[model samples]
Target: MKISKQLNKLKNLNVEAEKCSTREEAKKIINKANKAQSKINK
Candidate 1:
């Protein structure tokens, strides 16, 4: 349940990433999400 919830959150982040004006902007958003996810995992 937790994993699925986390995945859903990431999916939402992906949608937001697509809205980013530039590739670099998207990467920054995704990278922040990844860091947040890693912290959650730990």
Candidate 2:
């Protein structure tokens, strides 16, 4: 259940990243999502 929630959060982050107008902003969001994903994997 927690994992699913985290996945949903990641999905939202992806969406947010897509909406970002700047490459730097998008990169930041993607990096944040990647960190969250790594935590989930562990």
Candidate 3:
């Protein structure tokens, strides 16, 4: 949570990539998100 909060300090960072219009793109985003969450949970 603290690491994520610090990342929020970056003004250009886009945490919510909600503009995915393709299935492939969406899958890539979902996979990346899961990977990140797993790392944080560990």
Candidate 4:
């Protein structure tokens, strides 16, 4: 329950981070999101 809540929070935070208009900002966001997803899968 706690981990799932954290994951959902991460997803919402990532969504907000992804709204940045700069390429650098978006790249960082994508990388962070991928890492989070990988962690979740493991």
* TM-score for all models, in order of appearance: 0.55, 0.75, 0.60, 0.64
Please report, in order, the local distance difference test score of every candidate based on alpha carbons.
Answer: 0.80, 0.86, 0.55, 0.74
For candidate 2, write residues 1-42 as lDDT tens digits.
478877988999988987899989988998989878987897
Model 2 lDDT, full chain set? 0.86
The list of candidate 2 runs beyond 4 A from truth reads: none
CA lDDT of 20 in candidate 4?
A: 87
Clashing pairs in 3: none
- Return whichever of 3 and 4 wins on TM-score: 4
Tell me the deviation in Å of residue 36 in model 1: 4.7
Q: Residue by residue across 1-42, what tens digits does model 3's lDDT show?
A: 565743343222234456667788767766666655565666
Candidate 4 residue spans exceeding 4 A from truth: none
Flag regions of model 3 displaced more than 4 Å: 5-16
Per-residue CA lDDT of candidate 4, range 17-36, in tens?
85889888888777777766
Query: Positional deviation of 21 in candidate 1, in angstroms?
Result: 1.4
Instruction: Judge candidate 1 against the unseen true structure and give its global Cα lDDT, from 0 to 1.
Output: 0.80
Residue 34 in candidate 4 has what lDDT? 78
Ranking of models by lDDT:
2, 1, 4, 3
What's the number of clashes in each of the models? 0, 0, 0, 0
Ranking by TM-score: 2, 4, 3, 1
Ten residues in sequence with the least summed lDDT for candidate 1: 1-10
Backbone clash tally (model 2) = 0
